[model samples]
Target: MTQNRRWRRVLIALFVVVIAFTGYHAVRTVSDAIYWNAHRDEPIERWMTIGYVAHSYHVPPHVLHQALNLPPMPDRRPLGRIARESGRSMNQIEAKLKYAIVHARPPYPAPGPPPRPFMPSPSSSSPAK
Candidate 1:
């Protein structure tokens, strides 16, 4: 019957659409995976916390803050903000900080003993013999 043919055509069209949608997503997913594999070692550009970057580089947060020339603070902020405030691109800031850490100077010499407090000698209090 004509109604049966119409239903069959509709079903076929719907099947084709579903298959296309699924195939498109599958291709996109594969492409993304390939790109990630190729650039796994590259630095990411999205906003990231200073803590994350320092951790990734195996450097302490305070050390990274000092290396970046950022003012002392209790906690880290987003890298994008840091880069903007410093008038540099996010990538450039990250690169410079990474490079500085890799080539940083050796640690400063150990601190010396604390100075002793002044104490008046027993003989000095009175007249020496």
Candidate 2:
């Protein structure tokens, strides 16, 4: 009977912890979403991540990373943090990236004619004497 009671207590404790953790995350996500939605009309902050800026402006993530000279990483950190770590002024980086977006260029020039595949000579195809 004691063992059963202890198991029941452990299960209850686990359930409570799970509920608390889930509830905290749910509330945080909703609040953060609301805050960003309200700030949509404002200029993006330096503390905003590159991904956020790119998404807001309809820019491709990879293109933005290339423009900013940033390496591909799992998590996109804020541009402010990036500027500080790279010892560059935020304005400089922002200017270059914004200009790149405005003056976006194609990665390649106009396509040229496809090369023709080489074919074996007719003489050689005669079972090579």
Candidate 3:
């Protein structure tokens, strides 16, 4: 009977720990969502990576890379690093990224077949003969 009581206590403790852990993550997720939503339209910064900028501004990373003349890939390097490597000023890189974001076009899905025009049947159009 003591062993059974001890096992119940252990299970209760385990359950409490799990609940606390999940609650912490849930709170963190909500806070992050709020922060990102608030800053979604913030201007680009030199310290930000291309991926971050793309995510914040809803622009494609490939478009930003093309604007900067970088090869197409998942480049995680920060804008400051890219500027240093390319021998360009941070301002120049920022300008290019901003331009790309402004001019970036949303990718459209492939075209589907055109809808057929509606036509009434001859009998209906002419009414009862």
On TM-score, the candidate that comes out on top is 3
| Candidate 1 Cα errors over 4 Å, as ranges | 43-81, 87-92, 99-129
By lDDT, the best candidate is 3
Candidate 1 deviates by what RMSD?
20.6
Structural RMSD, model 2: 12.4
Q: By summed lDDT, which 10 consecutive residues of candidate 3 come out lowest?
A: 38-47
TM-score for every candidate vs. truth? 0.45, 0.48, 0.77
Candidate 1 lDDT, 1-129, residue by residue in tens: 999999999999999999999999999999988875664224634476766666555566677678778765754567788778778887787777777656554566899999999999897799757
Show where candidate 2 strays beyond 4 Å: 1-42, 104-129
**Model 1, clash count?**
0
Using lDDT as the measure, name the better of candidate 1 and candidate 2: 2
RMSD of each: 20.6, 12.4, 6.0
Superposed model 3: Cα runs more than 4 Å off: 105-129
Candidates ranked by TM-score = 3, 2, 1
How high is the lDDT of residue 105 in model 3?
56
lDDT of 3 at 30: 99
**Sort order, lDDT high to low:** 3, 2, 1
TM-score, cand. 2 vs. native = 0.48
Encode model 2's per-residue lDDT on 1-129: one tens digit a residue: 999999999999999999999999999999999987765424656887877876676667677677777776533788888888878888977886777666664455778999999999898889655
